[model samples]
Target: METIQRTHVTDAPPLPSPWRDAHVAVVVPTYNEAGNIAELTRRIYDLEMPGIRLIVVDDDSPDGTGALADDLAGQVNESHPGRMVVLHREAKEGIGRAYVAGMKEALARGADFVVQMDGDLSHRPEYIPRMLGTIMAAQAGLVIGSRYVPGGSLSAQWGRHRRLLSRFAGIYVNAILKLPIRDVTGGFKMWRREVLEHIGLNTVRSDGYSFQVEMNHLCEHMGQSIVEIPIHFEERRADSSKISLAVQVESMLTPFALRFGRRRRG
Candidate 1:
């Protein structure tokens, strides 16, 4: 992990940048991603969207990711002030809860839009500008950086089985839910604040990777306008994969539950 020199500020830096003026918040949920946190934060902060804030919702990673996030937040906030907010949870719950907490914080800060991404650097920060552009130009409630889209491609390093499983998951979820989205399992996404507000974050029940599918499902169910922009999906270089057998089981069960059990608009 990169070491960032800590800098302290006397007061919150003035929010006068384009990012702040637009009220854009990027919420990244993390667990044991210490190796990548600094670089990721640097890249996101380097974008320097003025008021663009990066929220790192850490699940109390034993590897000290939360502490590293604090360092990054301190360094970034020292210069940008209020541009980095790290929410350290008591224990590793799930991505769903981490996101809920971060999104709520974004909303509380009066954010107009919120972004969701993985902290392991799989989701490139370069595409953020385009995602934001698409959201505004297309007036989409949700903008997804999709691997299943025409121009999107997964890393060549991914094996056949991994590729097949990913493709199959998207196909299976879409078939069952009849969602207009092609990347039903995509994690790199941007959402208008209203979409999150309307979905009622507290009502979302998925506690594992299924959270991604469930969020997509709710957006489709609520008749929200969504746009998918093709993106290059890179494989993570550090830390063990979080996906496990239990998460896979939940991913499978989520489709059936959402399609049959859930009746509300979410």
Candidate 2:
């Protein structure tokens, strides 16, 4: 394990630069990612994204992901001067909760833009540049590194059934809540701090991975611009996916609730 520095950031930094100062922190919420965390963090830290930073949120992964995250942070602090933070939790909560925790940690540490993705590398790090590019060019509140967009494509490992389910979820959300982007469910999203601050993150309802859909819905409800960029989606090679049959059922049922529920849009 790498030796992660434990110093806390006490003040928020100024946010005025291209794509929110590229001071962006890619938040990887992990469960049992010990096998993948080190290499993944090393690759991203070496990618030369200028102000790009990373924060690994581990829900006290039993397989030692939390310890690995601390190690990664320490190595980053020693070798690189940019920034890396790790937030560890005591139990394995859902991804949605993990993300909320990460967002708060990032904001507390002065992150201007917070990017979210899977730690097993299913969402390619190479697309980080393109996503950030779109955000800067359009000043969009949310930029999705999408696989359903014009130039995006998915890997062949996913079966037709999986594809159909994903597409159906997109259509359902788009038609019901009427979000503006094609890949409303894509997790490889970048968000400007202003968007989170404005959306009232504390009030988000979705607790599963479907939280991605709810976030897009919130963005649309608030009339924030969303941009989609196509990219190849890679399959994970290490740990098994945390997605479950329960999540699939939730994804199918969430749009309907958001559409007709007594609450306002999002």
Candidate 3:
């Protein structure tokens, strides 16, 4: 494992309370996760962590995932009250764009910390408390639920070829970008609001799998403290994998584009 140098955000805005009093925003980007949306939100709300809010950014799925998300939000907020929100985008843009919109909304609503996770059950809600704990304990700028980290494991259902490809992708990206983080392409992550501010979300252009790489690259380029915790990544509870050949090609080509960018120092 490469050692990532940690740095602090100077003149940073006030951060939320570690676990209590902090306004935590969870951004769930959905495409066609209709089958899993209800359960996903229910589990998140069941955590019953005070100051927890869920923002479901739906990209207008033809399968009515957006409508289902709205229904779930309404049902959950009835008891929890203002704890869940749904942002319905006009059309499918990309996961990266949805996240940018959701994060911006969270910030606008005065969220102290923002988390990004898949709407599918693959990114378990059970590990959220642990992720928050890791960020606070390490005082990290970002905390990633990493599959490539020590103690992390992938789903047994994955075939050898899929596993090999994932490992190879990680190794290839690491060599090109030289990021100290183990799972650079992993989607499950939490960010301190200041890190997003420092990295300039508007500058991120990746629209697919490479989005994770772009965000990780920005964090490394800015010398932000990133902590990766072991997460057992399981297969999606519903829906097939969305990784297309175009996405794979984009992932393969992104590192070279980022290799020459100047690191932002403040």
Best by lDDT: 1
What's the C-alpha lDDT at position 146 in model 2? Answer: 86
Q: Could you give candidate 2's per-residue lDDT for residues 76-125 as a string of tens digits?
A: 77766548888888887688888988887887777888899999878877
TM-score between candidate 3 and the true structure: 0.89
* Clash tally for model 1: 3
Give the local distance difference test score of model 1. 0.85
Candidate 1's TM-score? 0.91
Local distance difference test, each candidate: 0.85, 0.79, 0.82
By summed lDDT, the worst window of 10 consecutive residues in model 1 runs over: 6-15
lDDT of 2 at 64: 91
Ranking by lDDT: 1, 3, 2
What TM-score does each of the candidates earn?
Answer: 0.91, 0.87, 0.89
Candidate 3 lDDT for residue 154: 94
Cα lDDT of model 1 by residue, 167-234, tens digit: 89988988888889888898999999999999999888888888989999889888889999999999
What is candidate 3's lDDT per residue for 82-185, written digit by digit as tens?
A: 78889999987778889999998888888878999998898887677777777877989999999988899999988999889888889999999889988888
lDDT of 3 at 92: 77
Candidate 2 Cα outliers beyond 4 Å, as residue runs = 2-21, 79-82, 262-266
Per-residue lDDT for 69 in model 3? 80
**Count of clashing pairs, candidate 2:** 3
